[model samples]
Target: MEPHVWPLYGLRITTPRLELRLPDLDTLSDLAAVAAAGVHDEDEMPFSVPWTDGTPGERGRSTFQHLLGTVAAWTPGAWTLSLAVRSEGEVVGRQDVGANDFAVTREAVTGSWLGQTYQGRGIGTEMRAAVLHLAFEGLGARYVTSAAMTDNARSLRVSEKLGYHPDGLEVLSVRGEARTFRRLRLDRAGWEAHRTVPVELHGLEPTLALFGL
Candidate 1:
C-alpha cells in the first residue's frame, strides 16, 4: 500500500461505523467472496447491467474483474473509485463513485452493493454518505446522481433520506426485458442540508488529480 504509482489506493473515506477504500488484491478477494455469497435475492435484479445474474462463482469473478477493469480504464477526466466497504474491521460490501469530465461538470454518480448478510443495517446509507462528503466537501463537486430500479423501494428510500430529488426516469433493457429506473439528483445545497453522518476523508490530497479536481 505505498501507492507510489496509483495514489488512489491511498484515499480513504470513513463514516462512524464504516471505512471505504480501494481494495488491494487480498481485500479485493474478500469483496469478491461477499458477492459470491450474494447481495440480492435470486429472483430479483437491482442493477441495470444484470451483472449479478450469474452463478455464484461467476458473480465472484465478475466482481473481481470489474474492479480491476475500472483501475485499468481510469483517466483524470473519467474515473471510478470502487471502494471496499468495511464494517467492524471486515469487508462487507463495495461502493462505487465515478465521474465523466468531472473537472468541467463537477458532478459524480454513486453505486453500491452489500452482502445479503449485511443489509438492513443502515450500512448502505453510511457508505454513500461517505462518498458524498468526498464529492462535495473534499472535491468541490456541485451535483451527485444515482438511479435505482422503479421497484427498488429500498434504494429509492435511501436516496430520499439523503435529500435527493427525482430528476427523471429512463428505461433500459435488463435480462432481455425492459426495466424502468428512477433517476435521482442531489445538489450541493441538498447534500449539505441532509448531511447527518460524520465523515472523515484521508489521503485524498494525493489522489485529487486522479479525480480531475
Candidate 2:
C-alpha cells in the first residue's frame, strides 16, 4: 500500500517492544481479528460506547469499519489517528491520538484498547508513551488528555505512569446506566519530565501537514 496519496499511511511510531502505524488492508484484518478475540471481560465495559458488546463477528467488523471511518472522516481541523499496535510483528491492539484545531489549541486526546491476552505486561504504558512522543515531540502539541471509567484502575495506572494528572470527572450513560469517568491531562512539561521510553518516529514529517502542523 503506497502512501503517495495518503501520507499518513506511511507514518510510524515505535517503542522498545511495539510498533504503531496505520494499518493497511491486510494488517487491518489482523487488527480486527484481535478485537474479535476480545479486549475485556464480557461483564465489564471499559468503553463508553458498547461496540464490543456485539458477537465475535460483529466486534471484528465494527473494529474494521471504525478504523476505516477515521480515515474517511479526517480533516485538517479535526482528525483521529488510529494506529494499529504491533508487538513481535503481530497486531496486539490499537493506540489512538486525536484532536480538533490542534494547530491553534495544541491539545490532543488519546484512547486505546489492548487484547485481553496482552494486558498486564506494561505494554499499555509503553504504547502510550510512544504516542505521547509523537504528540508532544513530533507534532509540537502542548497538552494531551485521556479519560477512563473511574473504576478502570488499569487504564488510570497507565496514565499516571506516563505523567498525566487528574483533570475532572464526568457522568455518562453507558449501556443505559450512569457511569463515572475520570478525565486526565498531561502538558509538555509533565511529558518531558516523565519520559522514559525511547521512541522512534518514522515518516512523520510528511504527515505533519495533515495534522495541521
Candidate 3:
C-alpha cells in the first residue's frame, strides 16, 4: 500500500544554518547515500538495533526502508517523523521525533545521526534542538525521552546540553549479549528553561492529530 502523506506537507523546522523536513523520494535517496557513506564504523555499534551491522549497501537500504515504513505505518496513536537534515541546501543527516499515544502521555522521543564527516560541527545539537522545539512548542508535548548506551558519551552530552536528566537505566540483550543503557527524560518546563536555540516551525497544526494530540 502507498504510504499516507502527512497532512502537514512541507512542514519545516529551521535554524540559522540548517533546515529539517520530512523528505520526499529524491531527498530520501540523498539521505540513504549519507547513511551508505558511513555514520560510524561497521565494527562499532552506536544504536541499540544494530541497524548498521550489515554491509554499507545494506545499511543504506535499511535506512531508506525504515523511513518509508514509518510513513506507511503512521496512525493517530503513533507516528515517526524521520526528517532529512539539510545544511547549506545539502542533505547531511537525519533527525527523528516520534510519539506513542501522545494524547494520553504527552511525551515523545528523539533520535538522530550525522554523517561522520559532519560530526563535531554542532549539527547534531542544532538538529536535536529543532525537534525539541517542535515537540514542546508545536505539539504541546509535556515530556521527551531518549536512551543511549552508557558508554556513548557524545550522545549523553547532547542530552545533558538539552536539559534532559538521567531518568534511570535498563539492561536489554542485543547481538546476543546483555547491554546496559541510560534513559533520559526532559519535561517541557525543563526544556524551556534551558533552551538556547532559536527555531521556527511551519505546517504543524494539520499533523498534530497524527501524533494523537
Candidate 4:
C-alpha cells in the first residue's frame, strides 16, 4: 500500500462524487467483480477490443489480468494509469488515462467502463473530469483524445459535455463486423472552458517522471 516500488500506486484523482486510484489487491478483486457483473448490454459491444465477450468468470479474470499487465508493461514512454472508480465507498468501475511519448506529444488518451448498474447517473462525466484534471492541470498535458463506437450515444454525449470535439472517424473490425468509431479530442482551452466538476489530485508529484513529464 505504501507504493515503495511503483510510485504511481500512490496517485489519486478525485471528483466531488468519485475517487479514482490504483487499486490494491482487495479493491482490484472488487473491480473484477464489477466487470463480471457486466458493463454493457450483452447484445451490444461498446468497446473496440470486445474484451467483455466471454463468460462472467472469464470477464472477471481478464479484468484482473489486464490491470496487472498494465503495471508490468509500463515504461516512461508508454503507460496506462488503470484506476478503480469508487463512489460512496464502493467500487463501481475503472478509468484509464494513458499516453505514449507524453513528454514529446503532451497528449493522452482516456478509456473507462462502469458496471451496468452504475451507468446513466452522471458519474461517468465526473470520473472523466477527474482524470482530465490530472492530465491537463496536474500534468501540463496539451491535449487529450478518446474514441467511442458511433452508436454509443452515452459516451459521445459525455465527451461532448467535457468539450471534446469530433476529430474524425475510424473503422475497426469488431465482433466480426466493421464498426465505426467517432474520435474525439480536447485541448487545454476546451478542458478549461468546460470544467464543471471540482477535481483534486493527490500524490501525483512523485509520479510525474513516470509519466515522462
Q: Which candidate achieves the best lDDT against the true structure? A: 2
Candidate 3 global CA lDDT score: 0.89
| C-alpha positional error of residue 69 in candidate 2 after TM-score superposition, expressed in Å | 0.4
- Measured with C-alpha atoms, the lDDT of residue 172 in candidate 1 is 98
Encode model 3's per-residue lDDT on 185-210: one tens digit a residue. Answer: 99988899889989999877776667
Which pairs in model 4 have colliding backbones? Answer: none
The sequence of per-residue lDDT tens digits that candidate 1 reaches over residues 1-213 is 678789988888988899999999999999999999999999999999988987999999999999999999999998999999999999999999999999999999999999999999999999999999999999999999999999999999999999999999999999999999999999999999999999999988988888886
Candidate 1, superposed: residue stretches over 4 Å from native: none
What candidate 2 gets wrong by more than 4 Å, as runs, is none
Candidate 2 all-Cα RMSD: 0.6
After superposing candidate 4 on the true structure, give the runs of residues whose Cα lies further than 4 Å from its correct spot.
none
TM-score of 3: 0.95
lDDT per residue, candidate 2, 172-200, as tens digits? Answer: 99999999999999999999999999999
Model 2 steric clash pairs? none
What are the lDDT figures for the candidates, one per model? 0.94, 0.95, 0.89, 0.94
Task: Write model 4 residue lDDT over 1-213, tens digit each, in one string.
Answer: 777788988888888799999999999999999999998988999999999999999999999999999999999999999999999999999999999999999999999999999998999999999999999999899999999999999999999999999999999999999999999999999999999999999999999889887
The C-alpha local distance difference test score for the whole of candidate 2 amounts to 0.95
lDDT of 4: 0.94
Consecutive 10-residue window with the lowest summed lDDT within model 4: 1-10
Q: Considering TM-score, which of the candidate structures 1 and 3 is the better prediction for this target? A: 1
